[model samples]
Target chain A: MARMLSGRLPDPPAAVRRGPPWAGAFPSTLHDQRVASLLGIALGITFGTCFLTGLVSHFMQHPPNWLSWPSRPVWLYRVTQGLHVTTGLASVPLLLVKLWTVYPRLWERPPVRSVTHALERLTLVPLIAGSIFQLATGIANIAQWYRFHFFFTVTHYWVA
Target chain B: MSGDGDGDTGARADADAPAPAGAGLSVGGFALRVVLVAAGLAALGYGVDGLLTMPRATRPSNAAAWLIGGIVVHDVLLVPATMLAGFTLSRLVRAPYRAVVQGALIVSGAVALMSLPLWRGYGGSVDNPSVNPLPYGRNLAIVLGAVWAGAALLMIGRAVRARRTGPG
Candidate 1:
């Protein structure tokens, strides 16, 4: 009998056999990850600070009138406010950079055996949607000098 | 017919990966980064000058002081205290990370609630005349102090717990 060579091969569905354009195309270096990490760190810190300040500002019943040093009439409320607004403005660039750095990974599906992949897919919605809403509403709030309709205010309040 | 032992298609698959013939990092990123640093420095400078030039009567007076106090209490005191307490509780209960973060956020939300009333322009400014600036400032302070006390207690409680449990 003539030797017909046999290397085991399982038939793949035609759709599976045809790879997407991005298949096997990954950055050869960690440059993207590094960019992402740096951007994430900046964003994380700025957002944390702004959020903390906003939280404190929410509860001020009587504005600070320095009791011991009762002479300084500096516009302290205005100053903290400026900080909050500025920090918020700064988040725009950081968010963009972060999204860009992680863009490539979104396409890569999980290998056959892991729940980690499922969880990532699930959380992606809230993380992205919440982030966008927070940033958008924040910018809008600043534009209006922190003024907004009660509905938007309430929604932003909860989302943030 | 040349029967090559190895079927080596040597054309690199990654040739397209590099920046296109003229493409490079986005100019916008560089421009935006410069603007951010400039704005931050400018704000810091203005804040410092305002703080320094503050009036020094028989009783020292500075609006900048109020802002600074607010900033410090919020960032340094309220946040750290809440975080420490939440962290302690998490360790004690073996709570999930999300729960801890949510707790901290909720505390922050309380502060934001207090700040809202003060934001409504009830307080008059030198530029913008107001009928009730005094009440405005007082109102803000009362809310802030109440929240501060609560946060401080939580912080102290966390410390006591930490001492008893030997620090997580």
Candidate 2:
């Protein structure tokens, strides 16, 4: 009763309520530059593949007067479209992980101290937003979810 | 920090962090910048062209909403979920076998995400026989079963190795 009345009975033991040493540590260390680099390269390759394939699909669907889409490969559209979706799906995991690895920097102090730093940070707006737009639109297009009134092909082609 | 690193040496040690020592321009760096500029211009030009030429029926507002919605969903939901799973796996599994477990999880997760549409019968089309003709659900099950089996074998191998090497 006396102890309770006092502001504090005694100081809590040091480290008494400490969590496990590795409790907060992510299994894949995000700080590792090598891992980030490798993941970035992989993500880049996947995006490149998706972009090129997407362009092919777009051209095939809306051929220019100068270009002709071959009808011999009846399965061409299916194959390219499948590849586009698959690559985009695969990118979901890669992009998530890549973003996770570099997420620490999002909260780094002195957010923008220099001109170069500001420019660099600004670039992320497009890089990230565009990537998200591409993947999201691609997935929705593949699923044929037309919740949006916009034509999928035209918007997707532009967003690509 | 070395000058001899191969393939895009201009890539900073951490993309979001400060550049490492000795970071400077190289052929790879120049190429990368050029490619990025070209791609950016192309995307912007194409997007603008599409918007200008788009049919009157297409709603720009809808497109904008979808674009923003995708970013929100990914950043808000998917990233955290993935981090939680990774943390949980790390806590549950020993270091020796963690890679196998993580690999299995990633593969299964990707396959599962890709298969959801099929599982929901969204891919089926009565009009076009060529599209989505495969038995997706069954195929997904088979692939997942094989993945788990492989993971099990990997675990067994790690266990045997640990026994031989005496646990670390």
Over B6-108, each residue of candidate 1 has an lDDT whose tens digit, in order, gives: 1000001011123211123246743543344344334334433433444232111322233244434433664456547545665665433344344444544
For model 2 the local lDDT of residue A129 reads: 62
For model 2 the local lDDT of residue B144 reads 95
**How would you class the docking of model 1?**
incorrect
The CA lDDT at A104 in model 1 is 49
Interface RMSD of 2: 11.7
Name the 10 consecutive residues with the lowest summed lDDT in model 1 chain B.
B1-10
Q: How many steric overlaps are in each model, in order?
A: 40, 0
Q: Any idea what lDDT model 2 has?
A: 0.63
Residue B113 shift from truth in candidate 2, angstroms: 1.8
**Model 2 Cα displacement at A118 (Å)?**
2.4
| Quality of candidate 2 docking, DockQ | 0.18
Off by over 4 Å in 2: A1-27, A68-86, B1-42, B45-49, B52-58, B121-138
Candidate 2, B1-168: lDDT as tens digits? 001012112222225334621235465754565455445445555565666677564466776676667667766887678878888887999887988998898889877865566656674357877655678788999999999999999999988988999956
Off by over 4 Å in 1: A1-21, A24-31, A61-76, A111-113, A145-150, B1-168
